[model samples]
Target: MDKANQTIQITIDADSGIPIWLQLRNRLVYLISSGGFAPGDKLPTVRELAVSLGINYNTVSKVYQDIERDGYIASFRGRGTFVSDAYLKNEGSAENEADSLIDDFIRQCRELGIPRQEISALVERRLKLTE
Candidate 1:
C-alpha cells in the first residue's frame, strides 16, 4: 500500500484513567507533530479506523472531529479526510506544541523527583538517538 493508505497502529487502554478517545487523539497529534502524517496525506476513514482498532465508530469520529478542529486534518466531500496544511502556514502552532509537550515532560519528571541535570542529559542522549 502507499504511505497514505498504510494502516497506522495506535494502542488504547479501555481501563486507563485517561479516556480512550483522548489516547487516540493524543497519539495522532504526536504522530503528526513527529512527521508521521504529511501535508495532504489521507487518513483512514472513521469507520475504517474504528474497525481496525476495534473501537466504537463514534469514538473515532469524535477524535477526528477534534483533530480537524485543531487544524490538523480536513475533510472534503467524496474526497475523504486529509492531513491539513494549516499547521504548515501556522508555523508557531507547531513549535509551540512541541515546546508545550517538552515543558509537560519536564514538569512530570520534576514531580517524580528527577533532577534537571539528569533530565537534560537524558534529553541530549535521546536527541542523539533520533539523529
Candidate 2:
C-alpha cells in the first residue's frame, strides 16, 4: 500500500447506518486534525479513491468537495488533491479550533438523526467519564 493508503485507515461500515460519504469525510477530518496527514500530503484522486473503496465516484467527489470547502484539503487541476495548510494555521487559535470541532460534531450528530437533548446527554455522560 502507498503512504496515503497506509496512513489513512478508513473503513466503510455499511451496516452502521452512517452514510459512506460522511464516514469517509469524518475520517479524513480526524486524520488531518490528528496529524495522520501533514500539510501538502497528496491524497488519492477522487476516481482512485472511489475505485479503491468500491463506492460510487460521485460519493468520493462529494466528500472531497465538501472537505475542500471546509479548508481541510485543496485540489489542483492535473496535479491532484493535497492536504491544505489552512488546517495547520487554524491550529494557532486553539479555542476557535475547538469550537469549530464541537460544531462539526454536533452537525454530524444531527445529520445522523440524533436529537439535541440526546446529544447533550451524551456529551454530559462522556464528560463525566473523563472526570
Candidate 3:
C-alpha cells in the first residue's frame, strides 16, 4: 500500500468504549492542532483511509463529514479534501486549551490512583517505537 494509504495510528483504548468515529475525529483534531496536518494539507480520502484501516468507507466518511461540519476541514467536490484556513488562526488557542485539558486530565488520573511514571513510560514507549 502507498504510504498515503497507511492507517493513522491513534491511541485509543478499545475497552474505554468510546465510539470509534469520535476517537478518530479527536485524534485528527489533535494532529491538526499539533501541526501534523497543517492548513492546506490534503487529507487522505475516505476510501483510501478506510481501506488502509480495514474499516468501512462510510464510517470514515462519517467522521470526515462531521469534522468538516465542525470547521476543521473543507471539502471540495472532485478536488479532494484539505485542512481549513480557520484552523491555523484558531489552532494556537485550541492548542493552549488542549494542553490545559490534558494537564488536568493527567492530574485527575493521578488522583484516581494512576501512576504518573506509568503515563510517562507509555508516552516514552510510543515515541520510541513510532520513531
TM-score result, candidate 1? 0.64
Residue 45, model 2: lDDT of 85
| Model 3: worst 10 consecutive residues (lDDT sum) | 1-10
What residue pairs are clashing in model 3?
none
Q: What are the TM-scores, per candidate, against the unseen true structure?
A: 0.64, 0.68, 0.60
Candidate 1 local accuracy as lDDT?
Answer: 0.80
Ranking by TM-score: 2, 1, 3
lDDT of 3: 0.72
Which pairs clash inside model 2? Answer: none
Residues 1-131 of candidate 1: C-alpha lDDT, one tens digit per residue = 36534455577888897667778988887777668888788888899889988999999998898788778899898999988867555566767778756875786679779999999998999999999
What is the Å distance of residue 75 in model 2 from its true position? 0.3
Q: lDDT score, residue 67, model 1?
A: 80
